[model samples]
Target: MTLSQDISDIAIIGTGPAGLLAGYETNPSLNDSQVDIFTKSSKIGHPEHCSGLISFEGLQRLNVSMPDLKKKIGYNSIRYAKLIAPNNLSFRIDRGTKAMIVLDRPKLDGYFAAKTRKRGCNLHLKCKIHKIGYTKGYWFLLMTNQGKKSVTKSKFLINAEGIHTHLAKSLQLPVPNHKWHFPAFQAVIDGVKDLERDCSELYFGQEFAPGFFGWVIPLNEESARVGVAVGSWTGNNTRKYFYKFLKSHPRLKNRLRKDKIVKTYGGIVPGAGPISRTYHTNYMVIGDAAGQTKATTGGGVNIGGFCGRIAGKYSKKIISNEISSKQGCVDYQKQWRAFFEPNLSLMKFFRRTLSFLPDKDWNKIFQIASTTGLEKNMKVTDIDLHGTGLLNYAFQPKVITKGLKLTPHLLLSYLRGVLPD
Candidate 1:
């Protein structure tokens, strides 16, 4: 059965962080508009992946309020970091304030989805968008569910479909080259008794996570989320290698009394760098789909939220005819780049250097960190990562010097590799 409907002013694909944020920002006053969201999942939040790590500023900026902090143990701070080296050298960072908070990933996404729904945004779950095409200045979307098909027409489209963007690829849009993708695997374990409450741990040894790193992010005292991310360049099955690494780690093995695996999740992280162009005609991409994730830390929630909000705000202008020129889309791209390009560029350089570094360097770096409080010195708030600028952290001399040295390398790499033709 075919049902024809008028084209919407905006159609958002994927109900993840970017899509939800866009919906909320578009009509903060809860005004009615022709907006529709489509998602393949049966529910708003399911099959959860992601470590759910964020900063205090991120929560505030995203307007997320968690009344039960204890329930969200994944939300914690890095009061101190202990970096262990091959030579047994360790570095520690003891900062008084909490540097990060981990959230319940599925719950957080659900919350965002709820907020979007409350604001009158139409949500279509379990709907798989198979093909998207444009004709006569209007975009057409073909979606199917349970042997049934439906069509959605929109004047503007936002692709928030995460790492795999079939719509953008179909149109031959300028997607970033997949030069530095990483495979990440995570599991929620229920019986870790000795995990720290306020601090998270990371293992940087090549043996543990070959092109990337391993982490134990505490959800609370009783349970923790353990995971590893390996760069694709390493050529290892991330899931298999992560389990092997977990079985070998004496510290992790000893604390595990029960091996009750709650869930297993894995996904690809696009670390190639942000897309050189985020917009084309009436379309834009955001979040992981746009390569907005941090290459160094694999963090994108804050950046994604910021970009989604910006996109939402801009969508109004496009709909209202305030900015009728193609330059409106260009303006959106420029604003997004202005906010995230620098940090992403720096992260790419750091990821490349770290990927190629010998295990000894990690050990040395950890050792230096243990003694010099380097982690403390370099502690950045979520806002800093989300275009707050580095000037706020300029007081610490060593951190400043290190960042300065890294800036040139990042800029050079961007120039040599990522600059638009």
Candidate 2:
């Protein structure tokens, strides 16, 4: 196979948000350099599975524009979220602030791809990369499609191949430990009425979603994306629970009877941060491949875009020799960790503690959160390292009190690193 001349300084695997964002962040006029993106899918956004809920701030941070198809469901101010016990006791939370926009996934992905192409990145659809290796400081990519093969080389490689980051895993880059993985199932339903215009619904309890929670995010007046996520510890198939929950929940039973199913989808979410390392000598990983999704909420669009931008900028530095050391790539890892690690670590702690709590304890915590205003608590939980002393101010009391109460068990669990077999 002969190499393509258009394969420029960076070869990005996957044309999802991460790869697209990386391309957008690259300096376009760098001596007529090409940024080549390869994807196995012949069509972009064909197998859409994401819920696509994101904050307005997240969109701006990624520097990606919104599409016309996005319908404003109003701002979601979560006054109280409940964990309903099997016995029907409800633990509720009242958090302030709002969880913003629910997007159309296909539109969002297409928007990013278009922006990336407009920025002069070469996007190759249906291109499956089989192998990658570094030679004389240049990275070589071997790809094939339809029995035809091609080769490309670049100074750096960015692996944004979603959860199945084949290239990074082959190189033995630290993929997230599988124990932290949670499976999610989603389906879009139409013909619903009297649904909360702005509010998203979350059901957290062992009976409903043993390890994680279930959600109903309204996308428009008549349609909604309803799903359930089960932590790996529960040993439950999330897809099974998705149907079971609809069948069992009285409220949803009627809705299901009335609504027609439009789409059904499922995927695994890495409910943790990266495994200490996300970069090697000449390669970087982003998005689900790097486990950038939030532990508590399976949200990754923001984090993926943030890391993609960082990786894109760092790629430029590495190629330009502005920072001429292997550590330049390491610095990219550092930048992501500095921004995401602390919160993700804290969130992992919370996930552990919450998972072990009995129904009564969960009810108590939810009751406290409800009284405190969930939206406010969400803002605190969403805090990144770059943000204020707000984490200390907002969560110190809760951490010292509730957090300390769970410390001993949590410490043991953390050290054991034991997950369900």
Highest lDDT against the true fold, candidate: 1
Each candidate's number of clashing pairs is: 10, 15
- Cα RMSDs, all models: 4.2, 3.8
By TM-score, who's the top model here?
1
Off by over 4 Å in 2: 1-7, 65-99, 233-236, 325-327, 356-360, 371-375, 379-420
Put down candidate 1 lDDT per residue, 1-421, tens digits, no spaces: 5544667888899888888898777663444567888899988766677888776666666787555344533365646545555454555545456557777777778888888888777888888888888888888898896569888789988889887777788989877556567788988888776777777777776777776777788777767778888867567589887787678776666765436778778877666668778887788788888877777777778788778888887886787777863766788788888877677766666666666556765664554345445454455444336322333343357645545545454455445343443
Runs of candidate 1 exceeding 4 Å displacement: 1-3, 28-31, 66-78, 86-88, 368-373, 380-421
> TM-scores of all models?
0.86, 0.85
Lowest-scoring 10 consecutive residues by lDDT in candidate 1?
386-395
Q: lDDT of candidate 1? A: 0.72
RMSD of 2: 3.8
The local distance difference test score of each candidate is 0.72, 0.71
Candidate 2 Cα deviation (angstroms), residue 153: 1.7
Looking at candidate 2, the ten consecutive residues that score lowest on lDDT are: 69-78
